[model samples]
Target chain A: MTIHYPKGMHHTSQVTNMMRTGKTTKKALTFSRRGMGLEEEINVANDFYLANRLAVIHKKPTPITIVNVDYPARSAAKITEAYFKQASTTDYNGVYQGHYIDFDAKETKNKTSFPLKNFHQHQIDHLANVLSQGGLGFVIIKFTSLNENYVYPASHLIYEWQLHKGKQSISYETIVTHSYRIPESLTPSLDYLVALDEWLAHINK
Target chain B: MTIHYPKGMHHTSQVTNMMRTGKTTKKALTFSRRGMGLEEEINVANDFYLANRLAVIHKKPTPITIVNVDYPARSAAKITEAYFKQASTTDYNGVYQGHYIDFDAKETKNKTSFPLKNFHQHQIDHLANVLSQGGLGFVIIKFTSLNENYVYPASHLIYEWQLHKGKQSISYETIVTHSYRIPESLTPSLDYLVALDEWLAHINK
Candidate 1:
C-alpha cells in the first residue's frame, strides 16, 4: 500500500472536495443516534483499528494562522484571532506497513453518478505526483442514498477529471469499471482498506 | 500505551496538553526555525512515510458546524459561516501493523520543562479512553532549542499530568525519568516511533 504527498506539503484540490470531506457532507443528515458523516465513520473505523492495536491514523487540525493569542493565566493561552489556511492535499493520509496511503472521501445523494466536480485539479496532480514517487493514491466514494461505496484510484479520477472535463460526471457503471467497491459492515463500517487489498493484488503488485 | 478523550466531543484539554508536552528538561536553544511546529514537521514526515511506503497516517479534517454555505456554482459550496466543533480526540492518529497507533505532536521553547497548560483535561481523558479501548497512545515532544525529540507514551504522560495539578508542573527530571528520549537524525528528523518500538517491546512481552 502506498499514499502520496507531493513536494512535501498539502495539495490543494476542488472546492466541494474541501467542504464535504469524509463524513462532512452537508445535505443535512437527520441526526441519527448513530448517524455520522463519511469522515466520522472513517474516524470510528480508524479507532476500531487502533483499539484493536491495528493502525495509527488521525484527522489533521484546521491549519489556523493564529495571529492573536492571549496568555491571561500562567497556564492558559486563548487563541483570539485566526485564519484558515488552504490545504495542499486530500482529506486523509498516513503510513501502514511501509506503504503510504493517501485519500479523499466524498458522499453524494444523487445515486446516479459521482460528479467529477467533487475533485480538484491539484488533487489529481498530487495523486499523479504520489504515483510517480511510488505511492498509493485513491478516493473513497459513497452514494449515501444507496448506502454503497467505491474506492477509485486517483489516477483514474485524474484522467477523467482532466481529459474528460466536459463529461460532467462519471456514472456508477464507470465507477464499477474503474474502481474497487467497498463493503459496509460493523465496527469498520466502510472497509475501504479492504479495497486497497484488491488494489494491492491488482495494481500495487 | 494509552491516551484518554473526554466526553461530549470537547477537545480543549487534549489540545492544551499537546502544545506544552515535554517530559524532560534540556539546555535552552539559541535559535528557532518557523518549521519547528509539530504539525508542519509531521506533515513532512508523513510525506516521507507516504513516498517511502513506510506508513499511512493522516490528520483528520477540522470538525466544523456549518451554519451557512453558499452555492457559488453547480458544484462548489463555500462555507460562509461555520464554527469549529470540538474534536473528540487528538488531531493525529493512524494504523500501523495490524496494531492501532495513535498520538499527538507537541513542541515547547522552554529549556528545562514543558508546561502542562499545553494539554487539556479533556484530551487526557480521551487518551485514557483510547487506551481503555486497547489502543497504542503517545505524544511526540520537540524541544526546539535542544533540537531534540522524544516520544512519551500517553500512559506515562497522563500519569504525570494527573499527579501534577498539585505540583504546578511536572519536573524536568521526572519527565526525563519517565519518557523516551528521541535523538534527531536524517530520514525522519524526530523519529519518535523508535520510542514506540521500545514501548511495543515491553507490551508484546
Candidate 2:
C-alpha cells in the first residue's frame, strides 16, 4: 500500500523547471501568485546548492514542544500533541566556503518599504552574536511585488533597527542604497552568496 | 487557563542546581537512573554556553511534515496531522570562537563497542561535508553503562566507517585510543570543547 503525502510538504519538482528555464515555470508562477511563500523557493535553492557541493546551508526545523506521543503497534511513534516554540535563531545557518553564513529569508508585498516588524529582536540578537564572532550574518529580503531581492547585512539592519525605533520601517531607498542586490539565477534561483561576497569585500575595505 | 507542560520538554531547573553544585542534582540523577535521555543535559549545557556568550550551539529540531492545520479563534494554528521526517544533518551545530562546530550526542548501553548502526549514513556524510569545509565535526558518545563520554572526531569516524565495512561496531579499545575523553564538569556538564581544542592542536601538529 502506498501513502499519498500532502503537496508542498516535500521537495517539489519546481526546482527542475527553474533550473532549466532560469525562471519560475508557469505552474510555480501560478502557485506563487496564489500566495505560496518564498520559503519553498529558497529551500529548493538550498537543496541545489547542497547537491552541487557549493554550500551546506539548511533551514532549521520548527521547534515544537511535544506534549503527548502515541506508540501504535508495529508502527512509528506519533506525536499526538505538540506546541510550536519561538525559534531563538534565524531560519537558515551553515558553513559556506569556510565562512559561517547565518541569515533568514523574508518576503514583503510592500514595494515601498520593508517593515522592521518582519524581523524579531531575538533574531537580531542572534545575528549580532554571529557578527561579533567574525561570522557573516545577513537577511535575504525579497520584494515579491517588485521582483527584486536584496542581501541586507546584519550591521545595516541593526543600525536601521535602532534608528527607526519609533518609525518601525526601513524605506526601500535605504535598503537599495545600503544593501547588496542578489542576482537571480537558474540552478540556485537566489544566488545571494554573490551579494554576500560583495558585502564582505566592502566591509573589509 | 494554565497549561501544565510535561517535565523535561522545557528548560529544566537542573541547570540551576548543576550551576550551584557543579554536578547533576538528585532529581536529574533519578531521571537518568530511570533511563531519561542525555538530550536534556546537553540542552542545558548549550543554554549555559549561550547565556555566558561562550558558544552559540543549538539542537536542530526534529523535522515534521505537517499535513493538516486548524486555526482557532485568536489562538495559534494547531497541527492536526503531521509525520516525522528524516533529518539530513547532525543534531547540534553552531559557531564557537570563530570555528563552526557540528556534532550529535548519542548514548549507548553497551559496555564495550559502540555499534556503528547508532549513526545514520546521512549524518556521517554531513559530518564529512563539514570537515571538508574546514569546520570541526565530532560525535559525543556517552557510554551510559560505564558513565563515560568521549568526543570522537569525524575524520576518525569516517576512517572507521570505511575500515569496518564487514564489522558492525568499533571496539571499546579503538574508541578509547582514537577519541578524546571529555572531562565532565558542573556548569557545562560535558565540556567537549576542551576535547575539540586538543583534537585541533593534534591535527595542526
Best by DockQ: 2
Q: Pick the candidate with the highest TM-score.
A: 2
Please provide, for model 1 over B14-69, each residue's C-alpha lDDT reduced to its tens digit, 9 standing for 90 to 100: 23433443433111121223445777777766766555544445566666555554
lDDT of 2: 0.75
lDDT of 2 by residue, B1-205 (tens): 1222222222333245346544356446444445446787778777876776667888898998766667889998777666788998999999876778889998899999999988888988999888776688899998988877788888899999988862499988889998987654445566566566567668779
lDDT of 2 by residue, A61-93 (tens): 998776777788998777776778899899998
Sequence-dependent TM-score of model 2: 0.81
For candidate 1, write residues A88-183 as lDDT tens digits.
667665544445566788989987888877877767766665655445678888888887778888888877786777358988888879887774
Q: Which ten residues in a row have the lowest lDDT in candidate 1 chain B?
A: B24-33
Best model number under lDDT? 2
For model 2, state the Cα shift of residue B32 in Å: 9.7
